[model samples]
Target: MSDTETLNKLRGVISKLARELNTTATSEGLTPTQASVLGLIVFRGPLGLTELAQLEGLNPTMLSRVIGKLTELGLIQRDPNPADLRAIQVESTEAGRELSDRIKHHRTEAIAACLDQLPETTAQTIINALPALEALAQALRSTHN
Candidate 1:
């Protein structure tokens, strides 16, 4: 396929996956952004406000509000940054980590079940493509940095 065609196909697949994940997020009573931010904190945290905002493509004010909401829910905590006393760092609480892990388990199980219905060869092909897919993801992520 042409590069444009390949890109379009990738976009369609990604959009479908995102919609599925969004449904799961909403079912847990969190906005997609809130779920995303929480997951990021659970996995990549002790993140400063500025770094988290940049990673999530959120403006600082908006990120702060999200942080406030998460804090109110007791899913995350913001403390003084050890590296920069004036700055704040955020990390997930135990409850937050548990919730994130639960969500991830559900998503993984759902995908695995779907894969089980595919032909063996087709499923293996998808698994084999993961490294290339990850490289593509990293390349895309770098573009936003």
Candidate 2:
């Protein structure tokens, strides 16, 4: 395929995958953004509001709203940062971690089922392209930042 065609195909695949993941997350009572926030907290331990907003590429107000909802659900805890008493840090509660795990499990299962239906060679091709795909993602993220 031409470069344009390849780009279009990649875009389509990525968009579809995002939609699928969002649907799975929503079914678990979390919006994609909330799920992402929980996952980040689980992976990174804790993050201040400003840091989390930058990481999530969301404006502070929007991130605050999502954080409020998550806090209300008892999935995450917001505490004053000891080092920076003025800033609040957010971390996943036990319930949040469990929910994040469940969301991850569901997403993995869904992807695995789809991959299982693909021919071995095709699946291997995708596996082999992972590094390149990751690099592309990083490059995109850098540009966004």
Which is the leading candidate under lDDT?
2
- The residue pairs in collision within model 2 are none
Q: Ten-residue segment with the worst summed lDDT in candidate 1?
A: 21-30
What is candidate 1's lDDT per residue for 10-66, written digit by digit as tens? Answer: 899989988886777776778889999999999997899888999999998889889
TM-score of the candidate numbered 1?
Answer: 0.92
Output the number of the TM-score-best candidate: 2
lDDT of 2 by residue, 54-143 (tens): 898889888989999999999999999999998899999999999999999999999899889999999899999999999989999999
> Residue pairs in steric clash, candidate 1?
none
lDDT, candidates in the order shown: 0.90, 0.91
Error of 1 at 99 (Å): 0.5
Model 1 alpha-carbon drift over 4 Å, by segment: none
Q: Given candidate 1, what's the lDDT at residue 120?
A: 96
